[model samples]
Target chain A: MTTTTTTATAPPTRPVVSRPQERPFGLIRHSLALGRRSLIKTLRTPEQLLDVTLQPIIFTLVYVYLLGGAVSGSTQDYVQFLLPAILVQTVLFGGMATGVNLNTDIGKGVFDRFRSLPIGRSAPLIGSVLGDLIRYVVATVSLLTTGFVLGFRVQTGFLSALLACVLTIVFAFCLSWIFVLVGMLVREPGGVQGIAFLVLFPLTFGTSMITPKETLPGWLQTWVEVNPVSHAMEASRALMVGGSAGTHIAWSLGFSVLVLAVFAPLAVRAYRRRT
Target chain B: MTFAFEAEGLVKRFGKTTALDGIDLAGRQGSVLGVLGPNGAGKTTAVRILATLLRPDAGRATVGGLDVVRQAGKVRRLIGLTGQYASVDEDLTGTENLVLIGQLLDLRRTDARARAKELLNDFGLAEAADRPAKTYSGGMRRRLDLAASLVGRPDVIYLDEPTTGLDPVKRDDVWTIIRSLVGDGVTVLLTTQYLEEADALADDISVIDHGKVIANGSPAELKRVVGGQTVLARPADPARLDDAAAVLAAVAGRPADSPTRGVVAVPVSGDAAFTEIVRRLADAGIAVTELSLRLPSLDEVFFTLTGRHTTEEAA
Candidate 1:
């Protein structure tokens, strides 16, 4: 009897504190916090890491051993050539996880909760984009480690090789916004995955990944020349191996800036309008 | 007095179907305003508009004197939303979900953690705080969802059918939580398909149907809107039904209508009249096989208002 009375009389705990005043730079802060959530969620589900970690290593082994002799005279030369394209290719596909995860997220009610919060509208989108930087880093490190193990050497210094990794990561980060847009409009995560395949396969394979551009048909060579993915691959290759990298670096940076400018706004707009 | 939140002449359409048709709603500060309706009666569309999750095609809505569309960010500071689906992140732990919401509200990391702990303890989730929300029972996930909404101490909160699909015991827990939130003087906009829930928790109830509010009043007033209750009496013999109707009419202060040949029912003002019917039927020597006073269910109310059976509402 006394227990019922005691329980009824006890006050409910509401530790919620109000900070009605708007904070400056809230975009950066909120994005960072949401990004932390993505990181934690990813860590808890280690299988999600298979795309970044496992894919790169497997692709490197297959290409360097299977196609290495056919593409180049020796497995040694092919491994060096394949490593740069493989890193860029892996991270570019790694960007798909961002969209697929987001598509799955929006299908649930979590995005509705985020939308109702006081954070900046684009914070969740940008935060997931930032949080996925881990995937790119993992792919780069895994691919490079596998490359070194197979006797593939970077002729350029360590700093230039590091710059090449940075370039590919930045390009992938910017490229992810397009997938983010797809995630927002598409009804299903499977649809996002489908579009990712439709977009990525041609873009990655159409590049001079396995063979030299000069050996391909004239029309194909022209595409490899203009393709942004090819620019990123060529930029990384030139940076890791000794070459005049200024033009390729400029084209890669320019493509990253262009994609970010066009797709970031579109993705954010789609998110706000999705409901 | 200015409302804690208000929506006026709000219209929203998805393709050719209008989800909300020029509806208006308002809730007083520190009180519960129940938006009672069946499924797809525009209750959720209305809540989403007020929560600033969905923009209305027409009309202006405000929360704490700020426009929902123009000043959405400011309105967000004053409001929290809980939907029928648990909105807490399934991948995150209970503590992590609440803490993330806290951090989004700009609380320092330490403060966010402390607040998350407090909420988890209060919601009876402290024991499972470290576990991912996916591992939580349905009730535990709902608690964490509610906890996530409360992390910022919003002045107004929108609960969109919060207890839908819950067991009775879990529902009672949610009701208790809602009552305590009201006790803390937070304004609430609670939508539910259950009329009893609205009557029990709402200071004012707005009865809506097909995207329009058909009635609005305190629970008692809304109850009376559909003629309150009925003094239903069934005759032991079909031949004696006329006498039963007369007895019911005399006691209920209105002419009784025979819904079926075997029974006569007349809407009564209160339960006190039910006792009068019992007394008068005995005086008249009328044999009633069944006699009772019954309150109107939501289906009955909708039937009375629109002359439409709520067959789909039940679905």
Candidate 2:
């Protein structure tokens, strides 16, 4: 067969171009991006959502059914007492997510990347702490909805209930700063968990989550009264149960701010060292 | 040419261990400086300091005339860094990873997305742009990591073993990207354990050992330090190998070593020695099959300066 060969010529394609734009550097923008990325991860990881939602519901149900009659006089009374405690317990435990997620990111070399970036120094710490607020809100709403479904009523008005919810979330949000510091100080995820538990267990269990501090032994009563978490739980419970707000609320708000003020800087300092 | 980066007596210590021992390095604008060393040789430490991720305990470093320690924010604005491994958020898609960096760099949302798209296309990651980085292959993840660093169009890029785990082909792809980066007037400080990588990509190389720079020069200049032309001779017949060896030995006046099954190697002083050896071998009717003179490879230079073979010392 006779054939003729011809070279194929094609028209030139447009050159690939990138139009660069100037970027501004500020704390707010950096923190917002850091927070946005973290929230996006939470959206992708449903398991993270499940932990905050499922754990509180199950823990509240089990505690009310098993320990209600023994701990309090009646199931309804126990429900009233248990709901606020569950709020504090669930949200405080949920704060562990901050440390766990921070440890995971650091272990995976994510923080190393953050270190190389030209972003605000406190962005990651603030972002992760703020990100855990989403988890806290989820747990709070789940517990409150479950309590309402279980025939537990909030004697406080709607505004008070909303305010109580805000206080609980804010308390948990501040608590996360401590765990964020723990996460930065410890290199391993398990170490973060251990340290978080060591600090949280005493602050939580030594308080009056189920029984009133008045019912405890003299020394134990004093310990519970002095426990910052107990004051937070008591203030939240009193506010939700139609009791008059007192020094407990002031102390809780003051203590939450104090913890945040102390730990936020510590966490930021540790994060700087870590990166 | 202006120095894109100049570090004078950069010293860094972690606890009592000195990670960098007064390292002095400079890279010209639009050129590549490859820091070659084994593991624990302080290559990464130097890159970290230059990238503004770590502060030097002594001396000073500057990128684009911004001090790495005192003016770290300005230095950071002028540089991008891709570390030994991919450090993007795996939970996010490749596009999201780049976009997040763009946003962190303070790009508006629209600008960030546009920059992300541009980088994804430039890095050959457009097809997997929507896929989470965890799903990407090692090479793709590395490319995405590089793309994320370029979101700000940094003037100086620090690549710390950018091809550490990549296969040869993938490594070549990265090398191509690095070449294009330098072609775009971007300075690169590359750290690598692969000597051939330095020989291929570096405008100048510094070989560090035990936290100190033991040698620094262009690849050709460094290779010349371990002087002598390598003479390779192959005999026409396997049985005549000894004759060829004797010829090489007699002409060179040094012991000839057999590198292969039938090839003898001798160090020649110059081209005259090479011609003389070839003449001697031809006169003996040895029918020399192969004769060539080669300058020492970077491996030989590394061995001569460090007193250890690259491969052996690397292990």
Model 1 agreement with the true structure over B185-292: per-residue lDDT tens digits: 788999988777898899999988878888999999987877788778897888888888888888767677765578788878887888888888888888778987
Q: Any residue pairs clashing in model 1, and if so which?
A: none
lDDT (0-100) at residue B15 of candidate 1?
Answer: 95
Q: What is candidate 2's CA lDDT for residue B1?
A: 64
lDDT, candidates in the order shown: 0.86, 0.82
Candidate 1 CAPRI-style tier: acceptable
What candidate 2 gets wrong by more than 4 Å, as runs, is A1-25, B227-299, B310-315
**Segments in model 1 whose C-alpha atoms lie over 4 Å from true places:** A1-20, B227-268, B272-295, B312-315
Chain A (candidate 1) TM-score to true chain A: 0.92
Which residue pairs in candidate 2 have backbone atoms (N, alpha carbon, C) closer than 3 angstroms, thus clashing? none
